[model samples]
Target: MGKLACFCILFFNVQLGLCMAPDLSILIVTYNSRRDIEKCLASLRDNSRGARVEIIVCDNASSDGTANFIAQHFPAVNLIRSAHNLGFGRANNLAAQHAHGRFFLLLNPDTWVEEDLAAAIVNFLDTHPEAGGCTPQHLNPDGTIQVGAIRELPTVESLFYQKTGLAYVFPRSRRFGRYCMTWWDHDEVREVEQAGACLALRREVFQQVGGFDESYFMYFEDVELCHAVRAAGYKIFSLSYARVYHIGGQSAKQAVSKNFIEFYRSMCHYFRKHYGAAGVWPVKIIIAVSELLMLLVLTLALPFSKLLPPPQAWSSRWTQWRGHARLLREVWTF
Candidate 1:
């Protein structure tokens, strides 16, 4: 089918509400993601089984022709094109409005789903009424377990530990690594406060919590959604059986500086929204001091980096130094 034909079908679905809704709607948002979207869609085509699934791709005004590629190759997909780059949360919300599925799966363009992943998610949600959402085990492309897939809500102490390098230095300490749940081996089915990257949630649950908080442009939207769902008395779960391979940083790496700044900016927004300014004052102080200290150290080491390894090269260290300086300035006002 052509682009016109796809739009016509989508229009009829919206106006008439005539088609039967599917069991799952896998929603993907793309911005210059043609490189990964093809393989991601192919995996879903080859592996998804035992469920009625509909795939929707919301293109965020990609200059790389990502929208055209999907329209030409994956003609069955319901594609929504935006005029500008609506950030991650807004793009997914736009896709969800066009979706007709009982469950919504927020899938990253960089991931490939396993054969039974969709079916398993449907069955799990059907059986566990108390669970509002669930996330699969995220594995690196090399097949190693991806840590930081599940975590608790960030608090002052957790943010301090993360920024000051205490979390990395004491990965297994329950006190220092509580936010990322670093002590857990990621080998069991259990309740969690937040799950990142990809997740599946009931339509009602998503609607009830008002979907991803559109205030976030890049990071912590998932955390905010999970927080709202838990506050509404639904459990967020991590399932060890289902797995997805993630090629991390596929999108963010394209604009490293913007992403770095956005990460810290979103963190401050999250803290303000949930913890209030006064509640998270200590976190702001921690971030400012840590980033400032790193910037100063990197400045002093720039001259010596030429004598060190490539990782410590002047160019690399200078880039990191600039990122930290910008990050420190970003959080200073917060």
Candidate 2:
């Protein structure tokens, strides 16, 4: 009778231990992302196996009935509807506060993960104690690679070169090379400074770094977070084992001017925060001049460019004008 009681107690303890293990909480922030939210959640729900995981959708007051759709369709999702768009950083931070998982994945609503993506990230983080965060290789909706993951932080010169298309002209110049990862083919895993759209971070490391900085309203927040993580002695890595399909530019394409302003402002915030006011001023001026030149070129070319065929000419001229205007607004406002 004594031996049987001891065995029963040990068995119960083992079961309790297994039950007590925590799961991952995938946190996705949405702002008028109704078009992609359903697909994103579905992919996550169907794919996240082998590890315990929960989905948290933090909606930034999307007027598009995004919250209602999720509530009705994805009953298992933990949804938090905000009163206003609190930008990406703050919304994710709000969701993270309620996340009960051992790890938190900051995913964009426009991205879809592979079935094993979450499990692979969990396994990688489990083995890599020094890694603070990890991101998967991102593919476009058409299966093309996206050029976002970069090893170097954006300096004023790098930004200028990239913005003005000088990098494409002289890809080998040290200044131009810094902007575009001149050597990277986007096929392999490598150390990256930031991967904003799809990234997973250990809860402890995330909390220790105080999460994403709210000062950055939209852009450069991920890069800033990476800097903070590295400062805290944690490594940021890109994992090739996992993949995500990113439907890029849904939000930014909405209003070109506002989006451009916010993006450039975020860039300025990043530069000033890291490189100081004095160092960033020169770069700011250069960016401003380059933007002015671009605007002049676009304004002069738009009329002539519009003389082509109806479909092709209209699209070509409109896109060129929009691109130039966006660049000018970003450089000057931010």
Candidate 3:
């Protein structure tokens, strides 16, 4: 009878060990994202394989029934509800604190993954030890390739060329124009400098770099993180095998004014950190003058240009300038 009890105890321990095995954790930061969160969760549930994966929803005080809906429908999801909105970087950081996986997928609530995406990314990273992060090719709802993956960081000149449509004038010159690789039809996998929409990182690398910088409230956080990862002797890659669909602008559309303001502020933060105040100051002044001139042109042309529809576009530009102006003002005062 004692021998029989020992055998049963051993069997129970084995089962417990199997059940406690760690898995990849998908961390999603959400705020009033009821419209697309369901679809996002459904995609993850369908696609995840090989790894024991867990979904974590870090909700930033979503009042539009986001929390209750996830609790009812996605009972398997680990929910962390914030008392107030902590913005994107902080919210994702909150979820990462509780992750138990070897790797972590920082996903947006409005993005849907393909069935093989998670597995493909895992395989790629497994083979490439130097790769710090992997992101799939993102597609718009209309099946067009979104330019989320890029080879170079946008400089002040690149921004000016892209904004003024001068990039189109010198299409082939890499130095004088934007070399977006927008027309490239190659299916080959390539190393990328940035991946803003969807990215997966090794838990170790994330810890080494200390995760996303909270100084950046929203925009350019991914770029900054990528820069840090590369500086730490890691590579960032864009895998062609994996794919995801991003319902772009969900968060931005919700709070248009605030989002624009925050985006410029984040950009300034990035500029100051990477480039010296002397270098960024000239660019800021140029951007301010160019934007004001564009706004003036749009205001005057509002009566005649229906095809161009300058007012709305111009207002958006003006808002961005105003945001940049605020950042410059703060920096100058400091």
Candidate 4:
């Protein structure tokens, strides 16, 4: 849409004004997310009723014919096909090329957006000039705030807390919970280091930083991109005003049975790229040894998993970490 047309459409409430062409491009990457994609699209339609929203879905060679299904069902959404699975960031980058919106909202295929989400986030960013990106608070399938979606940057101490299970053991520690930022209620808006599940940024930022590093096949790429955004002097904000129900890890969890080796690999790449001459070998070693420790602790705790006095949320995290350790055993190269 033209500049005047874009503003006129975005500035009015859906009830008061007619929805026109999308001012925000909703970018999604689909990799065998057959079960989740249908609801996701429906949610977009219902929640975005009065907004002119551009919906784009990039199918990464899914075996389940996810692309064709989307094309047949959601004809208004732009569908892009790839010969091979392009990982997460690559596919989004590919779809972004076709975007005509003023802002880009990178969404996961397994998420449901609230009615005001598109308007709230876009309006907030439009008013706040320096904010490079904004992310909604992620909701679980049960509608509670999802933990670990927002956090402080990774540090030796926070990594220690997470790897050693101290974060679970001490759920209230601001220091131990640094990486997860567990103390905060998430009811207020704030700046954060990472929020990938449902994130938004201007087209200029996407062009300025480029797509995620191809080396990070799936994970940690978001964190790396956050680093780049902040390095460019743009703040990353968490939108407490909006939310999305994220199924979380529909695609990544499929590879968890083999152990999240790809996930770990991405983590190593991120550390090496940002840490300079230090290289990844050291990070690799720490991760390997930490996974070993995690395996031992969780194995011992398995029998009493139900008996633990810790909050259910912490137990959920421990279960996830256990899966991480299991994958590390098979995928650990060094």
Expressed as tens digits, the lDDT of each residue in 16-125 for candidate 3 is 87687554678899999999999999988887876678888899999999999999999999999999988788888899998888788888888897676777877887
| Better model by lDDT: candidate 1 vs candidate 4 | 1
Q: Pairs clashing in candidate 2?
A: 264-334, 265-334
Model 4 residue 96 lDDT score: 91
Which portions of model 3 show Cα errors greater than 4 Å?
Answer: 1-20, 149-151, 168-173, 176-183, 304-334
Q: Which candidate number would show the highest TM-score if scored against the true structure?
A: 1
lDDT of 2 at 300: 79
**What order do you get sorting by TM-score, best first?**
1, 2, 3, 4
Query: How well does candidate 4 match the true structure in TM-score terms?
Result: 0.83
All candidates: TM-score = 0.91, 0.86, 0.85, 0.83
Q: Write the residue-wise lDDT of candidate 2 on 279-320 in tens digits.
A: 777667877787788778767776876475543222466675
Go through the candidates in order and give the clash count of each: 0, 2, 0, 2
lDDT per residue for candidate 4 within 1-334, as digits (tens), equals 6998878876775635434546789999999888999999988988885446889999999988798899899999999999998888888888999987778999989999767678887788789988988999988999998999887777555676787788988877887777888888899989888888888988898789885766667888788777887887888899886889998878766555332667776776677777754655566666778777767777777677668665333335465566666556643452
Runs in model 1 with CA error above 4 Å?
1-20, 307-315
* CA-only RMSD, every prediction: 5.8, 4.3, 3.7, 6.7
Question: What is the descending lDDT order?
Answer: 1, 2, 4, 3
